[model samples]
Target: MRKIYNSYINNFTGLSKEIWLLSLVTFVNRAGAMVIPFLSLYLVNDRCFSMPDVGWIMTSYGLGSLTGTWIGGRLTDKIGFYKVITLSLFFGGLGFIGLQWLDSFAGFCIGIFTLILIADAYRPAIYVASDVYSKPENKTRSIALIRLAINLGFSIGPLIGGMIIASIDYSSLFWIDGISCVIASIGLFVLLKPKEKDKIDPDSSIKKEGLPPLLNKLYILLFIIMVLTSITFVQYFSVMPLYWAKEHFLSEDLIGWLMFVNGAIIVIFEMPLVGYLERINISKTMATFWGGVFIALSFIVINITSWSGVLIIGMLLLTLGEMIGSPFSSALALEMAPKGRKGSYMGLFSMSFSISHIFGHNGGMNLADTYGFDTTWWIMVGVLIIVSILTIWLYKLLKKSPTFEGT
Candidate 1:
């Protein structure tokens, strides 16, 4: 146990001071975010919310996230990254605490919206901070380490949530989540040191060569992909447990453990793999990763039998694919960003997921209700396959285009 803890601590040696600070923030924020996976369950099962009502509540959170991302990006540019991060943490932690007091539907909506608003605000600042702090050679790894910290936090959060929910009331989950944010807030405040300001390259010919406008096109394509992929990812939160409960006779305890397993695998392996992949052709690697997601999702489409062990195996595959796509897409978005517009650029990337959640969470529930989980999974698989093909096509097109920035 001591050796394991030491290994985890030593992982930071490869990262710079700012990157380490960002990692701490990511871990804590994600630890707080674990409340989301079981949030639907809390609403419907615990609070007796109707399906449509749950949709609206989640939609409100997504809408708030959209606004928050824009605001966060704008603030980071004018004020600075550390201020934005600190404010986000303080307010976000308050929002989590607020969840404990929310009993009515309106109260739930308000609480969730506030939480997402603050939480989403942290994203762009962290990204821009990573970009500012690291040299080009380590930029991708810095981002990956940030993600790894979040995933590691995610790994622990759900397991802890599971144990807490099993033993206590669902409301207790909020307190656990809120406290994590507070602890992380302290760490972030102490660790983040401002370095030299990163100014956009005014003389860089790329903006003049049409790179700025090209991002809008990539934005559209990526949005479609995000909507499709998020439908599958949201299942881990929204509908999958219900499906297993209704169709597979799986207990909530087992479901929680499965979710924990998903996070644990990512925590253990996502970084090493990302570090390795950073040295290779990122676009091609992501295309292949999405292909794997398509195949892993097919297991659900073709799923007719009930086997807990097999389901776990399928989840491992899905997570493997997710790990590949997450960091690759983030780096791509960072690369696509125009100078001085890092916030909006990151805002656009953040918005993709928010928009996707609007569809993926609420729309996914509707789809699962109208069709079955099996059919829903098939729809997701088909879209993922399409995304993989399109990503590859885009890669080829960018390679040939004279306007492409990063080779």
Candidate 2:
């Protein structure tokens, strides 16, 4: 037992204090992530919004996320990540406070859009901080640590949120979430020191020495694959809850517990899983391919069976995929970026997932509402297969590059 405990500690030994604190901040922020997970339910049940209305509002949030990440990257490069992260957290908390007052459709739309724009901007800044704080060999582990913190908090959030909604009201959710964000912002501000901003001017032409991230063909292919995978993966939040509640006849508490299970699995396994993947010399592309495949299988299993016991099996598969894919994808983005452009690369990568939210939530909801849940699941399976193929192609293409030797 001592040997195993020591080995576990050894696995996480090399990361910096900044990374640890950043992980803590991530935990605090995500622990309050009750809003997004329950947003669709709130809109449909509480606000009495139509499915289309829900889709549009979610799309608006996605658009805000897309815009926020892009602009945040530029700001992080120009002004420094410290300012960007702190400001994003502080103001994002205020946005949530504002959201509690808005009751109409337009007000809700505008409120959600503004809130996401400020809140999601923190993503790239955090990624940049993760990269800046850790050594190259520990990069993947560092990213995993951050994700572990996020999932740990996520596990807590929805469970507590379930109780909150059950006993209190949605207004309490916003207040709690908002307060959490502000506290996280204060923690970050007190802990993280200011660093020199990236020197490259955003408006200037790309130096002849290296291609800009936007023009890099390999990176673009990776981004496309991310979009495809996220489209399928996002259904867990967007439609799965609705399906469980409406179709499976699960209660709100039960649905929250299911979501908690997803997070709990990731928190338990993600770090060791990344360590094992790295030790085995698994390529990021291959990990991603298998992850995509597992995600598809998760939904396929759901399509084939309705047993509640089987649902845990499916959720396990989905969580396993997330454990494999998410951190390595971030590591790959950092590995591929030019010096001084990590923020931009991370931003663009963040945007890929954000962009998918637009299509995933809107498209998935539309299909489920119109065609049925099974149709949506089948479509997800088809999309994941294509994404897996693309990942394979990406792997082969990377094998030819000079950097490929190290990757």
Candidate 3:
């Protein structure tokens, strides 16, 4: 027991204090993220929006997210990550606060788009910041810490959010979400001043570079795989709640507890898992391929049984897949980035996920509304199988790459 405890502590030892602070900021911001987990429920139950309308609204959210990441990446390169983060937090907070007043379909479309645009700009900046803040050796662990913070906060938010909705109302969720961002903004602004390296880059660096690394064929294929895999994984958030409610007649809090199970499992296991994988010198892409297999199996588990206990089984498998894949996949992207263009590369990396948001949520919801949740689950299994195959191909191709040959 003592040996295991010390090993776990050692995994956390080398990261910079700034990374910890940055992760704390992430936790605070995400801790109040009550609105998203239950957003579909709110739309269906409270606003009475049809599933098709919800899909369109989610599409707008994706567009906004896509645009936000692009702009944020450029802004991070030009003005610095600090300023970009500030803009995201402050404007995102105001947007969340403003969202409650918009109940009409058009209003929601515009509001969700604008709100996500502002909030998601934080994505690329934070990714770049995570890379910059840590020692090269500690980079993966640092990113894991940020993810842990996000997951830990996500775990708390849904559990508490379900209770809050039961007691107060969905509108209260918006207020708390908005207020938390505001508080996060204040904390970030007051405490975190990044080093001078974060400032505007020398334009000559881009000139010295030939084609951008993000435009590489290897990079593009990797991005596509991320999109497909993310699309499959994202349904858990977008449509899984509907599945639980409509199929099993679960209450709001029960759904929250289930979501909590996913997040908590990730938080508890991810860092140590990442550390162990790093020490073992495993192939990152191969790890991603295996993780995709688990993600696919998660969907398959639903069709195997109607027992509600299967939700736990699927969640556990999904969480394991996430743990196995996420950090190594991140290391791949970051490793591919050229020194001066980390923001641009990370921006492109982050964009893969944002693009999925547009397709994933809308497509999953549409499928659920059309064919029923079982079909949606089966379809996801098919999609993830493709993702897994592509990941394996990428892994093989990377083994031949001049850069990866040595590593």
Candidate 4:
């Protein structure tokens, strides 16, 4: 037992202090991520918006995320990840505060759009920073550590957000979230200094040489798979809470606990699990396939059981799938990116989730609203099955390419 514990500790210890600081910043920021998880429920239940309206609003947030990452990627290459991350955290925090005053649909749309656009720009910058700071062999574990921080924060956020909602109004969610972001930004501003290599000039000839990530054929296929997988995965935020409340009559506190379970499971298992998988030389492609299959199974099991015990089991499966798939996908993107364009590649990769949110929320809500939850789950199963096939094909194709020869 001691030997195993020592090995796990060594995996984290091998990383740079910069990586640990970045993870701390992520943890602080995500710790206050109270708004989005409850956004759909607040819109539909509190604001009395229709399901379709909620979908459109959520889609608008996605649009902002897409645009944010695109610009952020370019900015990271041009300016530096440090400045980009600092500005994003500080300004996005202000956006969250601004959201508290908005009540009309147009106001909500504009507010959500602005907040996500500024806030999500942090994603690619952080990933690029991680890649820049870590040794090549530690890249995957570095990303996992950051994810661990995220999940740990998430484990706290929703559980507390649930209590806040139960006792007070929704406005508190925005305030707390905004406050957290500001504190994180301050911590980052004081502690995070960019290394010389990370300070690439925008107009430098080397920075401009590589093809844009979107134009790469292999990356495009991977992006498509990302969208498909995220469509199923993102429903946890968009629809699952509403399902628990309306369909099962669960309280907000209970729903919060459910979200907590998702985050907590990842916190406990993600690093060690990812380390084990990578150590075994599991192909990123196969890991993704198995993860997607488990994700699909999670939904299928939910459809089959109403018991809380079974529901908790289903949530565990969903988190396990996330632990398996999400970090590896980012690591794979890092592996495939050209040397000078890590920011662009990571940006496009991050956009995959935003695109998923756009379609998944709108589409999933439409299905649940029209055909019911059972139909939605079955359709997700079908989507995952198709995505799994594509993932396998992508793996085979990559194997044939000289660039991806040994992968």
Taking all chains together, each candidate's TM-score versus the true structure is 0.87, 0.96, 0.96, 0.96
For lDDT, candidate 1 versus 2, the one ahead is: 2
> Model 4: per-residue lDDT, tens digit, 1-407?
99988877766768999899999999999999988889999998889999989988998888899889888887887777888899999999989988988889998888888889999889899998888778888999999999999999999999999999999989999999999999999999898865564243322236454578878998899999999999999899988888888888888888889999989988878888988898899887778778898899899998886775777878989998899988888888888888778888888998998898889999989999999988999999999999999999889998998877645
Model 3 has an lDDT value of 0.85
lDDT of 1 by residue, 1-407 (tens): 99966655554446777677688777877786667878877788888987667877887777778778878977877777778888888778778877877889888778777778887888887888888777766777788788888878887777777778878778887877777787777777777655444342222222333244225776556555655566567666676767666777766566677777877887777776666565564563354446446445635633756665677777776777777777777776777666767766777677766766666677767777787677777777776777677676666656675655343
Ranking by lDDT: 4, 3, 2, 1
> What is the model-wide C-alpha lDDT for candidate 4?
0.87
RMSD in Å for all candidates = 3.9, 2.4, 1.8, 1.7
Give the winner by lDDT.
4
Provide the global lDDT of candidate 2 against the true structure. Answer: 0.85
* Model 2 spans with C-alpha error above 4 angstroms: 195-209
Q: How far is candidate 1 from the true structure (C-alpha RMSD, Å)?
A: 3.9
**After superposition, which runs of candidate 3 have C-alpha atoms over 4 Å from their true positions?**
198-210
Clashing residue pairs found in predicted model 4: none
- lDDT by residue (288-311, candidate 2, tens digit) is 888888899899998897776777
Write candidate 3's Cα lDDT for 1-407 as tens digits. Answer: 99999988998998988889889999999999989989988998999988878888888888899999888888887777888997799889889999999978988999898899899989989988887777788988998899999999999999999999888899999999998898888888887975565232333145434347556888778898888988888788768888888888889999999999989998888999999988988887887787888898899998789999998999999999999888888878888777667778778888888888899999999998889888988999889888878887887788799886522
- Per-candidate local distance difference test: 0.71, 0.85, 0.85, 0.87
Instruction: Name the 10 consecutive residues with the lowest summed lDDT in model 3.
Output: 198-207
